[model samples]
Target: MVAQEQKSSHVFDLLVVGGGVNGAGIARDASGRGASVLLVEQDDLANYTSSSSTKLIHGGLRYLEYYEFRLVREALIERDRLLAIAPHIMWPLRFVLPHSKLVRPAWMLRAGLFLYDHLAPHMKLPKSRGIDLRNHSAGKPLKSEYSKAFVYSDGWVEDSRLVVLNAMDAAARGADIRVRTRLAAAKRVDGVWEAQIEDKRSGETSTVRARAVVNAAGPWVARLLSDELAVPHSKSVRLVKGSHIVVPRVFEGPQCYIFQNPDKRIVFAIPYERKFTLIGTTDEAWGEAPGRVEISPEEVSYLCESVNRYFEKPVSPSDVVWSYAGLRPLYDDAAANASAVTRDYVLDLDTTGGAPLLSIFGGKITTYRKLAEHAIEKLIPEMPVLAGQSWTADAALPGGDLGVGGFEAALKRLRDAAPFLSLTHAWRLTRAYGSRAYDVVGAAGTLEDMGENFGADLTAREVDYLIDNEWAVTAEDVLWRRSKLGLHMTQEQRTKVERYIADRQH
Candidate 1:
């Protein structure tokens, strides 16, 4: 971790629990405002829902039916802002919504598209338009029945990296970011929170004093409030399990597809990792206690079938290369169906005990910045020490500055500097690290200079960089979360990565 300016007593101005997008974002914004913040995470950053998203910074095109104009507008506005600041990890994606007469009529699709385009005038993406799928390249994979589609714009994101970049920026601004650490307990005392934080690696408990606390724990928000913090009112989260499957490139194209199911749900099939096509996201009602979520057999079948209704080539369970599941801790609106639940967030602030406690309920990735801004703004009155007026809107995240020439220009420059790197290898490094790719490949004159090959372009040098800089301690953190190289590597190669990380730490 980078060293920061520390208070002599170590009494922080803010103690943030959870290191997901919301918590990390809050830490970045709060710390930028000069708050001495300490953020604690039970596991790795974005280890759960934050990383396991459909990986889009979209305006919830489907939520228009549910009349969530406020969320969609906020998301649409924030989406452009994020794209402007982080072009390396974020870019524009055009979605093709094929006309399914049996599902929704063309008029409804057109109406929704019209509303979506006009809702946020600041949207830099082109407005929606009707397309002739019969002749377009995107239509080549679709069945003959789908002759038309509504093409609209949204942005794709590296979800896990987004969380990490936020945490990195926060740490750079003097916030202490502790991963693999759990918030054991806390109590209100003398207008401050006396919190017990335990480092999971060492199991050593330490007391942290903070004038204010923000509960941004995603799935465990309610449990932490009632159990650990012991000061709660009546806000809860409804766990909705969403799962996705990765398959070999289904078709060739940059444009993604949005399929409408018979059950009134929408499924997306996006181009992923240059070599594979990504399909997702079923909203299954979860009743069990929150834990590691996995895609059930039924869900895989459902996803395959959802796309089968439109695609020419059929996909089956055997074709799936990988699958993942995550729990969406939506605000408990008592909606009968999981899909009907609101994606909007609720921030509950309880100041009854003199010490302020703010709890965030439901949120999506697209608007995490705004959520953080609002969260910090609400606590500002109580935390007079925190200064600044919403500075994150104009700031660039760590490694986001790609200069005037932007991504393509930077890629060209990296390839020029590291002449030995293959086109694919250079692209991977640039996408993952942006301007910092040079640092990862520092002074490496050849492939051999990159150190030991852990298969699929993952070199020992890169692993060491992730460890020393990105807080990567395990192979899974490198292969799966840091980058999705695990999908392309063999079991033996993955084991090598595991052994290497173990040996390095030892």
Candidate 2:
């Protein structure tokens, strides 16, 4: 057993250093397994690479080419599990892939999709099917020259909300979640580890002692390993920068398009936030620091060109409403091409160095839960009394207890209770809050009871609930993570919210 280095007021079984999907998911899982957990984030939850992902809960069909069957199958299985558990936030979307004889032969696409269908346990999701693009609704917005299409199913997640929900769930299970609490330094004292946490807003510093520390800091994994843990290692992480563009919705229906580019890379044009089409992503090797990740004009042009090749409605730079870029903290496999770098995660457990420090290398949002399970399993040998069973796969998130009447039933309940609420507002409330929407809205019989309407589907009541419950410290945290109202809110509305938060700090 590791002896205590010094007396500390706050001591936990596990201390997680990142608030992205993996860190949040691990915190939630660890707390649920009866471990005292503390999760500290330098920024808001999902403020970094997690929110910047393409936001698909996919099995990685393309990974088939790399023969990553284990990863693909595990991810495929997790997709159905997440859909059943978080129906309000995640759902199945069909991707139409127009056949290009030059890129991939039809048979290869068919076989991959077939393996994806069979690899996972069949849930509510349907299998893939080949389609004649000329006759299908999916191809209505595609060029007439593309005749054949392959349609497959995968889950889509509201990326930031997913991170928030996981954090909320972890909090509910008694995890101490501290946002804007940056990890300044960590050192092993005797047999226990002590870490200094600095509150970004208060500018105050505190110390936390923990038996085990988890380095789940996404792109900053190596930095934490070297600078904080002071571990001497020579491992490098390949940072691949990916960018996405949001354009006006070109198709009439909910279907998304997957185009095969001449470079043998794929791009997705998904129906986003109802009125926008989300297209992405370019794989470029990034030497820039992770904190400086941003969309380049060249990458934006490449995305537009790729989409224009298959779709009837050609997109230009002017058509873009929003653009985002993130650095994928991939395991440095020394691959010749950036796109070919492995997406699978690697864990370096340093147990022999007085105290244990587990550093996570690479991972995706889709497989966060399973990754947490594996992480916990790795630590069990060190702490033999720890429980071995996994509990997250069947567990519901904070608001996920409501059965799969899907999002509609929750929305209907909200509307029926508050007859005065607008359809748009009610739907947004239900979708964002799930079964717990009423808990915040309360028995408000009228709009006045719900408090001030800030902007677009946002209200004072919701903002208050977020700050009180989800650790929303800033205006950007509220608009982006707790909700997507920032996209629809005007500058004046956002400024008002910012002012309100600033005033509250004093």
Candidate 3:
């Protein structure tokens, strides 16, 4: 039998590739400004790099030494902006950088902190200051050698959820979001992009047309340009593998610690999931294929040793419960090593053949919003003018209606209204869904009404909601990305969820 070809019914003004934070934010910004948008992803939203982040909305404090003052300043500004818009998924986090004269002298640390404090004058987080570890609460978890430290403020984010919320907002503002949909190929045809997109689930190929394409393909940015679109480009990304390990809680504190290594690199031990400490990230370079990314045994050992130097209790590879690694597609700035490579993004817009193709290179989670806004501005000339073109700078994402510092109030409201919910269950709902927790709760007056509870209070209702709304297609999507309940679920329970999603989809 001959194959049948399917075409998307409507042509979009902008076709965004990748469903990570940058692509989602671009879709949200463009669609909100009256541009018809279509965002396609090969897997679930944030299936890779976006979700495997340090999960901090920080200004890259260490970037100061590399003379990345401008990048740091821009990130700091966006960090504040993101906090106000999505306070539910983000919160204020203070970092304690233990001072070591051997690694970095006190004067050098103070000068760097001073620059960090004033780089963005409008920064809402508290200014950096020196502290006596002997008297500070953060000092209790440290070894005796660390006598002084510096405290500065940044924000923490539920990384993957932030990506989903952006995609949700874009969908709400009239963008078509297709997950588990891969863009196979595309070329300029008749002054637009005629592309082949495949449904990864059903193996069905379809065609979509768009006036412009945004290559937010993260690690695949360069390959997409040369192979898929067949567009010639001079810019490329340096894929650096960053790995993180989660161990049983290492310390008893809300604040986090940033440790200095003998090699002059820094490692962070962050309080995670209430019962574990999140430690990461090696600067090892990744030169292999894009899709397969994993933390090597060496990287794991490096991270453990990096943190053990300061913590009163030591951590080893055997103590790690879960570990993850992601590739950082840094714009290849011809830096000597991966550690010195710039973390700032560069938008390469080409209008060579007919339509516009915008390739995003090198960016962190803290700067995605600004990157999106900048992307749309660059493409505005290529696409039609949007009426009343207001940017997403001040817009609140879906369920972000709770004002700044209102997360606790929102949690209280959820508990009061849903008296049947355990505080832990209610807290998860509020943080993930925010003002929409009531929607997830639905009209259920009892826990049983929400249906079967497994893996520490994950209910049938919540899973259904994720399937129907958030484009969650698989069990891993629910257990790992949507929430970190996988860590709590037994292998048997996880299998049940996998079967449940499959059955529900059918």
TM-score of each: 0.97, 0.96, 0.98
Extract clashing residue pairs from model 2. Answer: none
lDDT of 2 by residue, 1-506 (tens): 32223336766889999999999998998888888899999989998889888889998988888998898988888888998788778888988888998899999999988888898675457888999978888778877988998888888998888998999998888999999888988888767678888888777777889888999999999988888778776677888999998888867887877888889888988988878888998899988777847788998899999989987888999988878888889989899998788888888888865678888889888899999988988888776524757899998887777654667777887788888889988877777778988887887778888777878857777788888888898998898767767778799999988887787778
Worst 10-residue lDDT window for candidate 1 reads 1-10
Highest lDDT scorer? 1
Residue-level error in angstroms, candidate 1, position 218: 0.3
C-alpha RMSD (angstroms) for model 2: 3.3
Clashes of 1: 0
- Model 3 lDDT per residue over 13-90, tens place: 999999999999999989888889999999999999999999999899899999998899999898899998888899
Q: What tens digits encode model 1's per-residue C-alpha lDDT throughout 1-506?
A: 33222123567988999999999999999999999999999999999999999999999999999999999999999999999888889999999999999989999999999999999876689999998988888899999999999999999999999999899999999999999989989998888888888877876777889888999999999999989998757889999999999999998879999999999999999999988999999999988888799999999999999999999999999999999999999999999899999999999999877888999999999999999999988998888877587899879887788777999898999999998999999988988888989999988999999999989999999999988877788999899988999988999999999999999888
Candidate 1 local accuracy as lDDT? Answer: 0.92
lDDT score, residue 225, model 2? 80
Q: Kindly report the root-mean-square deviation of model 1 from the true structure over all alpha carbons.
A: 2.8
State each model's CA lDDT, in order: 0.92, 0.85, 0.90
lDDT for 405 in candidate 1 is 93
As for lDDT, the candidate ahead, 2 or 3, is 3
lDDT for model 3: 0.90
